[model samples]
Target: MTTLLPNYLGGRWQTGTGAGSALHDPVSGQALVRVDATGLDLPAGFDFARRQGSAALQSMTYGARAALLVQIAQTLQKHRDAYYEIATANSGTVRNDSAVDIDGAIFTLGQYARWGAALGETRALRDGDAVKLDKDGLFQSQHLQVPRTGLALFINAFNFPAWGLWEKAAPALLSGMAVVVKPATATAWLTQRMVQDVVDAGILPPGALSVICGSAAGLLDNLQPFDVLSFTGSADTAALIRSHPAIARQSVRANIEADSLNSALLLPDAAPGTPAFDLLVREVVREMSVKSGQKCTAIRRIFVPQAVYGAAADAIATKLAKISTGNPRNEAVRMGALVSREQYQSVQQGLQALSTVTQVLYDGRAQPLIDADPAISACHAPVLLGARDADGAQAVHDLEIFGPVATLLPYRDLAHAQALAERGQGSLVASLYGDDAQMLADSARALARSHGRVHVVTPAVAQVHTGHGNVMPMSLHGGPGRAGGGAELGGLRALDFYHQRAAVQASPEVLQALGL
Candidate 1:
């Protein structure tokens, strides 16, 4: 029998009733572990975190809390190889892909530690300089932000089991809030192990961190008014969370990251064979193959100048064709399987939906896998689809395959390209590639209205610019409308979600006495 991963809650480790749900290896279709939350006392856990956890963290200064982050990072770094092993077994990710999740998580924790240390020995943050309420300047009003006296509940998606947890936890913890993580069940082992290591090291105060690896059924139901919730998943589930009584009636804070059909555009200035055009193709292939295109920020729509649409499609296809998909354990395999067979089927269905309006520019469905059984493994090759008429391809804009699949679309001009890109409603990012400075700037400016981030790539910064899908801690990572109108991870700005902002109007002398 596979070991049922224990859930950490209420300052102790507990196991749920029954045999539990099995977590499988995506590449081998083998059961690795089990998780079940049935009969767990979730209400007690939340109360404990809100009380004991909150009090302990609030008593510490920002620098003290930062020290905890550094310790956690160091602890995880010691077991770095172990995390990669679990990721390959459970997430079916290669070394490079695993680094994006495990290493990214460690880096985020350290980054937050450095940023938090800069805050020094302070319990609350002053929002802005005090402003005089009257002409005499005797009375002033100052805004301040303090950590919320509650816990943060994170519902993360499957694609990034490691990075997703720490990215949210680092900010919340640094802001002096306790955290409860619900990693997606399909790939929960790595998350569970990291939490276990931290807990065993006793680096944090009791109840400061907890992990519930099974059904999220009753997790949100126990939330209090002061509690904050953040979710990264499908739009349907995001809608459910938004409408939950805990969020709607009780006024619980919520942040959501949902469906995003991000785009990448090749500007007309960089014609065929130019550095700009080549950069666009290279980036697209990287985005599509990395994490098997399961990234929420991955580019779904490729828009190129109508004159060079064929060239861009062929170029991207040529690069994608070289990526070998199979078991991550194989040294030669460049791409791995989906997180599960269910995700594989979903990708197939999404492909069928797009097939109505788009033609297959490059299909890797027939490509042979390396040392993996096609009948059992969930592996899938990268696929590239094309649409001749950008405006008429409604499905291309509305649907996302959530796998190694991307569609190529042709635009008439820069204005048409911007318009086509906006059809995604709102997206996490839209990248523009070209050498024309003015055109790139104008297009980025226009795209920013609909996209949370507009990445401009020129020949100059081609090597230094971060990849299109990478979610750097220094930039905003969420979008509006269909992409879920939420914001996260912009340096210290992420702390805003876990803090309560209030403006105190008082005499200048009284405000000065408060010491901000």
Candidate 2:
């Protein structure tokens, strides 16, 4: 029998009140589990975190909180294999992909733990140098970074259940705030199990961490002035979250990371046959297949010099042709299925939208799967589309097909490539491939205005480059405009989102007494 998924609230795991949404296994289209937050007490959960959990965390120094994070990391490491199993079965990802979510979560926790230690025993982080408040040296002013006296509510996407949870949770917990996580309903099993393990290990204080696996119907209704909410999903939903009356009335702080039309640019200097050219092809193919190209950071648009556009498109198609899409458990399958049938259908609709304007260079739905039935399973082949008249194809730049789909467009020059990239409004990341230092520098400067992170791939860094879609713990991951104007997980900077900054005007004697 498939077990009923429960919501972890008020320091205990409790089943929901009614029949919930059925989560499916993409490989076999089987019902994996059922979850719902029906009748769940949102106020009680928020109160527990605010009163009990927040106080416990607030009592600890930064060093002690860091120690707690390390302990939680160790506990999670012990269950890494179990976590991977849940990811594969529920998320329809291969072992390697599972590792990115499962193992990546553990790595993020460890990294934050290490970073928190470097902060020493100081609970309040100082913001910049102190300023003289008066003519006399005795009077001075400085800003202090202190933990917000409330709870953090995290609403994550389905693409990355594990890493998304930890990446957001680590800083919140480290900054001495409790967290209540709302994992996407499609793949909540992994998140539910992971949260259960942490709660079982007794690593976190009671009510410090809670998980709601199903509908967050009234979740936002319980928001208080001190609570911070972080959401990762579509822009439409983000707008609704922003419009919530409680949030606006109480002035609750919220951070959103939404969908974006990320791009990869190829410089004219890196024509066909060069190592940089080959590297761009390989990187695009990888991003197209990884997580079935469901990543928010995945490259949606490929910008290439007009002279080499045909060569680049052909090369990408050749590499994509070799990909084997099927059940992730199959060793020979290079790409896996989408998370669910609903998602697969959604991708089909998105593809139809793009097909209206661009020519389909490669259609995955027309291809055969290696070990699974494409019709029955959630598998789809990687589709590569070409926009010959890219300058006029506004749909190619405006619309986003959130699957193993990419649109290749031609640019007049390096400046044109940057202009086309910026035309996406704003992106989480934009990459340029070439060996010319001047071209890379100039293009990067222009692209930086619209992109959060610009990845410059040259022959030198091509061999060791982390690729264009990978989001690391030590680097900034958020972008402006359509990508969401909030930032997260930029090393120590991530802690700022969970902290309350206050400027203090006091005498030097008072500052010294307060340990500034």
Candidate 3:
């Protein structure tokens, strides 16, 4: 049996004095670790981190912090060869799926470190350059960044143990703030291991990173004003935490990155057997399979024009039937299990509910689904759908069935396509596929008002495109409406939410003279 990964607090391994819960391997359906979740000394844990870790991190310069971030990325990359196994044990995702969350997260942090280094320029940090002041030479200033003088809380989802943590923690660390990470109870082991590796690498200053493995049950209750909390999970959970009157009363900065009803549009131009048609099929398959369809960024809605609805559905069905699902180690396996039994049930529930609004074009319900593999903890086969009414559109538009499932909807016209995509209310991403640039651009402009991110993919640009599955470190990974109007990436802009920027004034001439 695999032993538990201990929680790290104040730069040390901490195991609570109680027999905790067992975390089973998602791939093997066996116990991986028995975590110590109860009796976590929260008051003591928070106190130690705030009193020591927070202060130490605040003293570091941005460059110093940036360098440390680079170091962690390199270290994590080195140890990442073994990460696939860890991910498989907890998530049951195929290698490709795991990479999207594990390796992808490491690469994202490396990118963030590079971007943060551009803050200082020769003109700003050099000795001679200056900015013109107020007319009287009495007021002038240069903008600079300071580490936010508070803490950052990361409450992550079970589906992405590594990505969720790194996306929030790395930026906060590089921006010079202490981080208190609360991993989900169901899948905290991988996060625990990763955090330990991060600490052992010595990238974090002592007390700068703290781990609370179990029940963050009451952690949010103690938050204060100006303190920042970033969460990546359910909208309901975010609602509960942000609703804690303390949040509004104190104006706490709560950033939520939840999965919303996102869509990928197959424009009227996608003729059967055309390149755009093929690209649309590939795009939908990739999103549904990547991360086992457990990503907040997954495309849950597949919108097709009324003329090609039959063709699109047939193409998707053919592709869905060809997908291989089973163990992650099985290289031929393009799709893998959902995160857990509970996750499997959740996806099933979503599909059952969506059926109420739409018809299943390809159902895995009595079919040979990946979930049938008893060796895995929670595996499910791919499911394809085509909807007939607003019931179908509204079901997919409203509910995010987080898994390898896509609900294809038909539209009467371009306006209707845009309207159907909008019915999801708000989304993180809305993708349109066509070789016609003008048409895609026009549709995007019309629907851009409803989505946070837009992608226009066509035969000409398909090879060079990042594809719909990739979320860059510099791009915003969230949306408005049911998607929880918040952002996770956008370079230093993400860090901005963590730090408070106050303008201080002094004349340029006075400042220059003082230096002399």
**Ranking according to TM-score, highest score first:** 1, 2, 3
Candidates' C-alpha lDDT: 0.93, 0.89, 0.76
Model 2: residue 39 alpha-carbon error in angstroms: 1.3
State the displacement of the C-alpha of residue 470, model 1, in Å, after optimal TM-score superposition: 0.6
What lDDT is reached at residue 420 by model 2? 85
Clashing pairs in 1: none
Q: Write the per-residue lDDT of candidate 1 for residues 187-253, one digit (tens) a residue.
A: 9899999999999999999999999988857888999999999999999999999999999999999
User: What would the per-residue lDDT of candidate 2 be over residues 314-408, giving only the tens digit for each residue?
Assistant: 89988898988898888998898899888889988888887778998877666778778766788878999998888888887887778899999
TM-score of each: 0.99, 0.98, 0.92
Q: In candidate 1, what residue range of length 10 has the lowest lDDT sum?
A: 507-516
Residues 1-516, model 3: lDDT tens digits: 557667887567878676777777666677877777466667676666666776776665566667777888888888886777788877777777788888878988888878766653211122234455677656765444345566788888887888888888877877666888888877887778788888887777777888888664577776767568888788888788778875768877888777678889888888888999999998898887787788877888888877788888888887777777776766777777777777878887887887767777886544554434554457777888777674345556778888888888877888888888888878888888988889988988987898888988989997898877688777877788767788777776777776665433567655564432
- The TM-score between candidate 3 and the true structure equals 0.92
The candidate with the higher TM-score, 1 or 2, is 1
Off by over 4 Å in 2: none
